[model samples]
Target: MAARPVSGAGAIRVGIGGWTFEPWRGTFYPDKWPHKRELEYASRQLTAIEVNGTYYSGFKPETFAGWAKVAPDDFVFALKASRFCTNRKVLADAGESIARFTGQGIVELGDKLGPILWQFMATKKFDAVDFAAFLKLLPASQDGVRLRHAVQVRHESFAVPEFVALCRDAGVAIVYAQSDDYPAIADISGDLVYARLETAVEDEPAGYSPVELDRWADAARVWAAGGQPDGLASVSDPAPVMPRDTFVFMISGAKVRNPAAAQALIARL
Candidate 1:
C-alpha cells in the first residue's frame, strides 16, 4: 500500500511514449502474448510509460485503477492531457474542458501517476497573455494527489525568454522535445525535467547508436543532479545545484523500436 520508491535517492525514469502500438505486440511483447497482459509485461521491463490513450478519450476511474493494479509498485504512468483541453482555438476558453479532463478519473492512478503532458499543436504560436492564463488554469492538485505538469510546445515561437520565465514562475516544466521538425529547448524551468526523444532510426537495432544512448544516459544523470547537459540548445541558464527528477521517453521516429531504445537507455543508466 505504500508508494513505490520510483525516485528513491533522486528520481530518473526511462521509457517509451506509449504501450499500445500494434508493431510492439510481437517484438516487444511475446508473439502470443495475451492482449490483456501487455501492461504487465511492459511495466516490468520499463520503469515508466506515457499514456497517450487519454489524449483521445476519457477513461473510467476503474480503468485507471485497473492500470495501477497491473503494473509493478515501482512503475509510473504519465498521462497525456485530452485533446479537448489542449486542442482549442482559445486558450482562455479551455477552462471547463481542462476541468472536465482532469476530473475524469485521473486521480485514481494515485501514487502511480507521474506527470500530465499537455501537448500543443504545431500551429499554435506563443501568446504570452493567453498562454499565461492557460497555465494558471492547471490545478496544483486533483482529488488530493499533487500533480506535476509538463508542456510540450511544438512551434518555434515558444523559443523565447518570456515563455521560459512564465513556466519557471508557474513551476511547470516546458518539455524538452528532441525532433528535427520541432524546436529543441532544454530549459530547466522547474525542478523536474521531462524529455521526449524522436530521433530514433529503424536501421539501428537499438533505435539509437550506443554512442547516442550513452550520451543520453549521461545527460539524464546531469539533470538528476540539477545541472544542464552541455552542447544542448537552451533558452534559460543552467539549473542551480540541487537534486531533481528526470523523465525521458523514446518517442516517434522508429516507433516500432521504441521499447528497445528505452531498455537500452535504462541499461546504460
Candidate 2:
C-alpha cells in the first residue's frame, strides 16, 4: 500500500474494491480527468484492486487484456467470482456455473491477476459436506497461470473448525472481512491472506480513523510476514513463523472515500 519493496516472495498489497466509482472523480482522481483513463490513473495510486465488475457481469477477453495493458507491471487486480456461481441455492451444484465463470477470459489478465474472491450470501449457512464439495470445485489453475481462491462466507455458521479445516485442506484463503454485519473470522487458511475493511465512514477524511488505519497496517505487516494478528477472531492456528504475501482492501461502507482510505493505510505501511 505504501509503495514499499517486498523482500523475497512475501508482499503486502493495499487497495480499494474497484476503480470506476463516479464519486472518486473529484476526490480521488483529478476532477477533469477522462473517465476512460480512470483505471490507468488508479493503478498508479493503489497497489491492487478487487475487480467487482466480473461479479455482476462477465467481461470479454479483450476487456481483461485492455485492463492489463493500462496498469503498472506490479499492479494486481483481484477478481470477484461471478455471483451466479456463489449465489445458488445448492453449493455443490455450482460446477457448471463455476466452470463457465472461470472460462470467461479471466486468464487474459495474466500477471496482473490476483486472487479470485468467492463471496457467499449471509443466509447460506455452512453445511460441511456441501461446502466441502463446493471447495473441491475450485481449480488450482487456469490455462498456465496458477489460481488463488479466497472465500468470503457471511453466515455465522461458518465460524467453526470444520469450515477452517476444509479451507485449509483445500488451500483456499478465508477472507477476513471487517464489518459489524458479517461474521469476523481471520483464519489464515492458505498461502495468502485477504482482508476487506468496510468500516470507513463518510465524514472521516481517510474513511477510517488514523489510529484504525495504523492498526490495519500493523496487522497487514504481520500477515505478510506469515503470522496472524493477535486478538482478531481466528479459526485456524497458523505455524508460528511461516510468512506469506497478504492483500488488504478498503471496501464498502463509505464507498466514496475507499480509495483515500487505501492510500492512507498504504502510507502507514
**Model 1 regions lying over 4 Å from their true place:** 1-9
Q: What is the lDDT of candidate 1?
A: 0.87
Candidate 2 per-residue C-alpha lDDT over 1-269 given as tens digits, one digit per residue, 9 for 90 to 100: 33444465368899998898888989999989999999989999999999998899988999999999999888899999999999988899999989888888989989899999999998899999999999999999988789999999999999988899999899999999999797899988889889999888999999989888889888988888777788798766664456677899999999998999998888887
Residue range 1-269, candidate 1, lDDT tens digits: 11122344257898887778899988899999988888899998998999998999999999999999998886899999999888887898899989998898889888899989999999999999999999999999998889999999999999988999999889998899999897888888777889999999999999999999999988888888777888789876655666677899999998998999999988887
Q: Residue 79 error for model 1, in Å?
A: 0.6
**TM-score winner:** 2
**Cα lDDT of all candidates, in order?**
0.87, 0.89
Q: What is the lDDT of residue 218 in candidate 2?
A: 85
Top candidate on lDDT is 2
- Cα displacement (angstroms), candidate 2, residue 36, comes to 0.5
Q: What are the RMSD figures for all models against the true structure?
A: 2.5, 1.5
